[model samples]
Target chain A: MIATTTENDSAEHPAVPTAEADRPAQSEARRRRLPFSPWHLLLAPIAVLFAFPFVQMIMVSFMPSRDINRLPPRFIPTTVTLDGYRGLLERSDVLIWLTNTVIVSTVAVGSNVVLCSLAGYGFARLRFRGRNVSFLAILGTIMIPIQLLMIPTYVMFARLHLLNSLAALIVPWLATAFGVFLMRQFFLSVPRELEEAGLLDGASRLRILWHIVLPLARPSLMTLAVFTLVGSWNDLIWPVIAISDSNLFTLQIGLANFQGVRRTEWSLLMAGNVVAVLPLLVGFLVAQKHFLATMSSTGLKG
Target chain B: MARSATVAVPEDASTATGAGRRTQRRSEQLAGMAFVAPAVIVIVGLGIFPAAWATLLALQKWNGFSEPRFVGADNFERMSRDTDLVAAAWHTLLYTGLFMPVSVVGGLLLAAALNRRIRFMGLYRTAIFVPYVASAAVTGLLANFVFNPEVGVVNNVFRVLGLPQQGWLEDPSQAMVVLVIMSLWGQLGFVTVIYLAALQDVDTACLEAAEVDGASASQRFRHITVPQVAPATAFVVIWQTIQCIQLFDLVYTTTRGGPIGATTTLVYYLWEQAFRQLSFGYGSAIAWVLFVVTMVMTLVLVAIQRRRGGEQPA
Candidate 1:
């Protein structure tokens, strides 16, 4: 099942090996010969500590409210119930919030992939006046702290009457400078011969990009999509400021408000958190290798 | 089409193809502009345009609604006298001072432990990294429950051990400490992953040579491993510091900048002033200060890294 999923995920860039393929056979042999390492003594406890909150979140989500409210709270509940999930669904706007978050993230990912790739390819492969200058100016925006822009952005959105709507959340995330930068880097590394061959075949630049470049650029596109999705999904402060309407609140804003109003509702809060986090968690688990590889490589490069 | 086909022929037809090539070049330039138009619009309209507007807003006094009256330097003057800003700055400094080193070093140690040929290395790595994949709001929600003063898990453990219970997030003095812990929990995974990748890229030959000699394990780690990961360390530190400076989501969700303002970091303070208090002009002033501080710190860190002969962070 894992192998099949890995294959499906990397279907775009078949020429590049998956993380599993990168593991050497000698490591498997070595693992068998030395099953124990002293690092485990230190690592085991730390891993448990790291994983404890997740375990607790899951366990407490199912715990009865009485059990949660009891003094000296129980790590493992004696009784399990669906009351938390039920309450979250019936009483709160968690479902609406989840849907809104999904819509925002999906739009963010889609726009970033389509737009950043085009811009990145333009900067990487095409010859044009002021291309270098424009790219540098865009890159410089990355250093301008988002905090510095928020107040004015809020005012601008208000003037444009875009505030209190999903557009406020979606517009800022449509195309990021980092996404453009990452895609440009990836396109620069791609061998030019493929595109050159296409040009010789009388293909327009757009046709070449669509047929020859984007397919090879899938890994980078995936990386950009994942980052943008995570960022938009988890965004809080901006939504908290821009969207005052309860009906349009994203999951983070909804959950933050839920916690504020129902501080004592531990089970409900846990279930809300679980719902907010589970999609990304499942995604990470499915493409763990790709996620790790992308993160590390991107961190090193940018 | 004929021009493309003739391009495969010899340069003897260069004069006829030159005009075609020039047109092709012009078309390519137009295509480039067209391709980049959407991204450039968004970047300039949202990112750069708002930034310039922020500079102007910083110079004017507006409560976000009134007609902007030009008040030169008044907002910045207010910032100098704003005690809340000072307190928030101190808290931000304190958070960075504690959070940066702890997370970075913890990440290094964790990465070193996993950088071996062992069973279930993937599992260990995944476990350590899962928190980073979770949203900060979710993490803050969990932290609130786990650190609740009366009925939370930590207090429960304290009771189980017959130790005195202490107020965590609700405590004025300990709120920042709890905030740091929560931030570290979510960020250490990212730092570890970077360090782990760097560790894997370390020269195995050098380590083997050191082992062949009389270098002890700790000595080898210090001499070989530490220096090898310096660039990664620089990257991690700078990243963590930026994150620490922009520390708002966790604070907003958890403490709302505090039990008596103990955990109010710079970004959180700016948010409160601008959004909550409707002090947009003063907030923009604070925002400019933050931008300046971020740039200076980044440059200084990069300079230090370069002086040590480490590669600049990309």
Candidate 2:
């Protein structure tokens, strides 16, 4: 292993070596007690403001449809019913829609993890002809507003009979430029010495990438997976345009149909909305650390 | 990482009698190509290929099922006369102009708050960040319920406070305002996170030095902290501007470019033309208009930055 684990050019966030856990006996318990501030009061309310929506959504979803549409809306549910969630799961195509969404997002996350990690390694650490040009070409596409490209992409997909299929939904997401960029940024932080040592020991390039670099890349891979999952799961516009078969609709498109089912049925729609947003909410909670790091490190496309 | 795999070829192997080095070099090249091939192919096919094709398709007249006929500059010419496209364009600019500043300044203020020595910081962070994770489509849907004229929480609060309940999402002028509020609420978390990170990296040593000079907390923040996060602020502005320009899903779910198209942004207009109207060529033209508008705005922002004494942080 290299003596220095940090890369010189990885300027985004320099790695700081953690201080020794066992301090000398004379200096034991030296950590200071921080002073208090009244900022907690200001912050608590804003936090409540941001988090109250999900609570409201959950509360309303359980209330009977009749209760939600009354003249004065009730903030507290007097009687919670499983009718909304039950009607959704049993009476509608919600199950199939959820299944399709999971399948699409899973495939998207898996492929993006594999492909973006590989391409990211290539761009970040390898030297090949046309490397700069290729990277630039990919990066330049980020600024091309999706609107400018959607019309022709739809036409092309239509011509190829890819419409109404899961392939259409999965194609554009298979390897995003953003994913590649994110991976590259992470890979750049990996010191080159580890690979050189592997090379000296007669490890092949792919073997080195797989055995050494990939293990070190788990954090970034997880971040990318979560991002891709959230994106593909929450996607709405493309699915609306590409998939016409109700059987193939992702959660967003399928959930949107709730609006049409009952124009102003707040309870049914809120239940569906909660169901649609639940996975991501859970996913974020599960991967909160990585999500925070990823957001801070990169500028995600909204 | 093994960049030498293809650097030493068979010829070098023969001359140097260095079998290990030669294999490694050749292997590196082949492996690099194999590693990147899948993603590059997809990017080229779905991304670069369509980008080029769109420019060509914009010059023709064809629906999804039909044969293309050359229309020369007809679509672009027609765009100049499209009132809906024009209105959408104006609304998009308004959205960007208003939303960009609020998201940036509000985020900076929130980040400044979060950066303090406060208790339950993680709880605050988690709660504040919840909205940002929800998809705009979901946000828009939930917001519709929250801002419903009769039963919405806003009206309910207005009633509790002994005030008039305004027509929120229903009225044309109020519709855009509600949409902007939704956009701000959802985006506030993201921008705050970015600013908080930048705030943490704001050279605490400099602030400590300023404290030695007897500067007040606000003064140190005004001088050291704000100036330190200037680069991040610039980035947030540009990034948020790009996002504002692509405002579609939320509008798609809530407004659908309605209330007489008051809330129609450029993207919504583009979708309507291509998908709803099946006017692919005209839609492509409108898309170009959006692309151009984004470019001009970005350029203007950059130019203003250049003129404002570009004092980049080290």
Top candidate by DockQ: 1
Tens-digit lDDT track of model 2 for B1-314 = 13223322322211224875576566566666666767777786777888788888788887867788889899999988888788988998888878977899999988888653334766787788777678866887877878888878888989989999888878888888888988887889889888876765666667767777778778887888788887678778878888888999988788788788899998898898899888888888778767877888777877776655465545
Candidate 2 chain A: worst-modelled 10 consecutive residues by lDDT: A14-23
Each candidate's TM vs. the true structure?
A: 0.91, 0.89
List of clashing residue pairs for candidate 1: none
Weakest ten-residue segment in model 2 chain B by summed lDDT? B7-16
Candidate 2 residue pairs in backbone clash: B4-B25, B5-B24, B5-B25, B5-B26, B5-B28, B6-B25, B6-B26
Please give, for residues B153-225, the per-residue lDDT of candidate 1 as tens digits: 7888888899998899989988888888888888888888788667656666677677677686688788888
Model 2: residues with Cα > 4 Å off, grouped in runs = A1-36, A300-302, B1-20, B212-214, B306-314
Local accuracy of candidate 1 as per-residue lDDT tens digits, A1-302? 22452365344322222222122355446655545655677778888888999999999899998887776567898989999999999989998999899999998999889889888988999888879888988987887888998998998899899998988999999899889899998889989998877776667777778888898887777778778878899998889889999999999999999999988888888999999999888988887665665667557344
TM-score of the A chain in candidate 1?
A: 0.87
DockQ per model, Cα: 0.41, 0.37
Per-candidate local distance difference test = 0.81, 0.77
